[model samples]
Target: MGEVDIFKIMKEAEKRKKIKEKPILVKKVEIKEILPCLTTPGYIRFTAQADREIADVIPIIFLMFPPGKTNYSVKENTLTLRAFNRMITFFPNGKIAVTNTRDKQEAEEILQKIIDIINEAYRSYLKYGKPSKETIEAAAKLSWMDIYNSLPKTNCGECGYQTCSAFAVSLLQGETKLSKCKPLKGEYFKNLERLKQKIGEIMLNTLGWE
Candidate 1:
């Protein structure tokens, strides 16, 4: 099979496992207040919630303005926010979704915490706007082939792999450790650390990390 096929298989297996898992219950929630902002050409409103502990487990929710023009859909924990220019998909821990334009005011009054985060991200965007492609590419290129080649070519089982190529694939997927190569000790190990930092930067800047 091709490398892409292998990656697809791994991703499918992971998705299935995630799907089988149940989400924790979020209860006794209250929402209040709404602040308006723009998600793109369309405007958005901040909604707040009270009496819930859904933080950290889910993505922040926002109520889009001119509501029916944008749609928010949820399947299990995954939430997709669709707008004219952009589509954002995330898993939300809170029991909140963007309401249709007709219910805009009511939805805003009920989900207070959601309102807070939307406002924050909006303010950040106004100040910094979107991150540049050059910045993102710089982060992606942080890791070099030289560091990858320096790894022990042996497919030693000590790293819990039958082959070095397998380990390299894992590294690219953020699944395996460079130290597991065993032969890459000292300065070589340090270089691996640097490469990881770069990879992490890329993942963050590009929103590629899950």
Candidate 2:
């Protein structure tokens, strides 16, 4: 008999678990805005408003994040965080702003995720005051200009992008890699490596890594 497909079985089981899990019902939430992402064409800026007052939770969100991984202004009561491809900003007035989301479903999923994180942050704050500031630096947000500036700028079609700026946007979206740029060599290649490292650090921080 062929070996049992344990990996496939586990994946199926996980899928079933997801199906069984109840969806988060964000009450009175509406998409307030949708705009094109400035860094990446076709990506979107999505904003939503919720019925509940979340101002009290902004501090908790700040307390949960490691210092350099997020941008929080206590005076303003706002917390800005990056999660995956989305840039999330929490406002004091129960409104949330999200950027770089691909579609409505993704925006909704990110909203649910932000709610869960905020709740967790509140609980942690109740117990631990605030997370200690760490020296391990991370990017709070990525910019296309940063990527574009680091790229070879040869505008070669080797990466299947028409322009270097297009490739940079794709890099920010995780659609392409520096190694794919045929013209990138020597100092330009080193710059790509550095950009890649920066991106990796940002990705890890987004996952709540300290």
Candidate 3:
């Protein structure tokens, strides 16, 4: 068979195996509504669904409320919800990072119902908050200089610049493009692209971006 046919057959075999596996079934719950928190930058929302139990021992179930603001938190379980102008944190689990927010009685009511629904499903684990400052700083230390050096140093000015070093500095400052390094075509270009993504993630998670 051709390479394409071989690949297709492999995919089909994988699908069959997945389908044969037993599925975990949990009780489902419905969410009536969620209230808004105005204190934070983003809105808070809640959902009622089948969630894992808190622990094998505990009978407590959980409902998840997520913050609309991406920069505020990263943990999926705990969230900072905004109610009007104030934001509240809630923790469904015992973890440090996990927290929940609810501003009004109506929101609290919705959260309780969501917790009930999740209890019907699988066991739940504690959630944690965002990474610590030290962890973020470590990630930033990885640096973008290596990728910068790999670029072509021709200084041909094809990318509308005077020198490669100048462009690199600009890239670091978020002023110029990595592609502006004319020599970074082919595999080197792709590698630089990957580096860019990694650097961006580090900057966003650790340094905090605008």
Candidate 4:
């Protein structure tokens, strides 16, 4: 049996306690308006307000959105994404709109979930420092065809896509892994290197971010 250090155990517990005690950036949100959701005929949209600005957290929350469903405008200081079966829009001043929910309670619950997302991103920022600035335009400029041409084009079905073109589409959507192509690790190794250069870090790291 290993000797346990009681002081070390107490220090670890204090560290976790301090983390839990950290104040949340978004304590609560108040629903300001409710309207029929234009995009989804049967759903409702609720606009809400937060206690503080959350613009800085957008980059960290990018992956929280469904693949291919996110758009961010640094110039406009806004982010829009479809996630959790809802369309959500965010602004720098803490204004938020969420569609596909009904009534105040439902709206608050959904916004609370958003707060959780924000808290998660905030924690990461505090722990790791700010994320590196990515070349969003580069990812935006990439076409599925560009990815398709760079692939082995074997249509091997090892990646679960029926055709190389389909896989390319999935890759562009950030829905599929480049390593899943299989042949890239073997016969098509050079093509893999070429793809890395063309696609840059987004594809190389399989983050699919822009």
Question: Residues 78-117, candidate 2, lDDT per residue (tens digit)?
Answer: 7887666567888888788888888888887777777777
Lowest summed lDDT across 10 adjacent residues in model 4 is found at: 201-210
Report the C-alpha lDDT of model 3 over 116-203, residue by residue, as the tens digit: 4343323222223233444333333433454446566668787677876666555544455555555566545665555445443333
With candidate 4 superimposed using the best TM-score fit, by how many Å does residue 138's alpha carbon deviate from the native? 2.4
TM-score of 3: 0.28
lDDT of 4 by residue, 102-139 (tens): 56677878988888878876776576455454434344
Top-scoring candidate (lDDT): 4
For each candidate, give its TM-score against the true structure: 0.29, 0.48, 0.28, 0.69
The per-residue C-alpha lDDT of model 3 at residue 77 equals 38
Task: Provide the RMSD of all predictions against the true structure, rounded to 1 decimal.
Answer: 16.9, 10.2, 12.7, 5.7
User: For model 3, where is the 10-residue window of minimal lDDT?
Assistant: 58-67
Task: Give the number of colliding residue pairs in candidate 4.
Answer: 0
The stretch of ten residues in a row with the least summed lDDT in candidate 2 is: 131-140
Q: lDDT scores for all predictions?
A: 0.43, 0.65, 0.41, 0.73
Q: Give per-residue CA lDDT, model 1, range 1-210, as digits (tens).
A: 545688889999999987455332332444444434444334454333434443332222322221222232322434445432334333344444343322455444433434444444344444444434443333334342433454656565777878666655565444554546565664456555554454333233222222
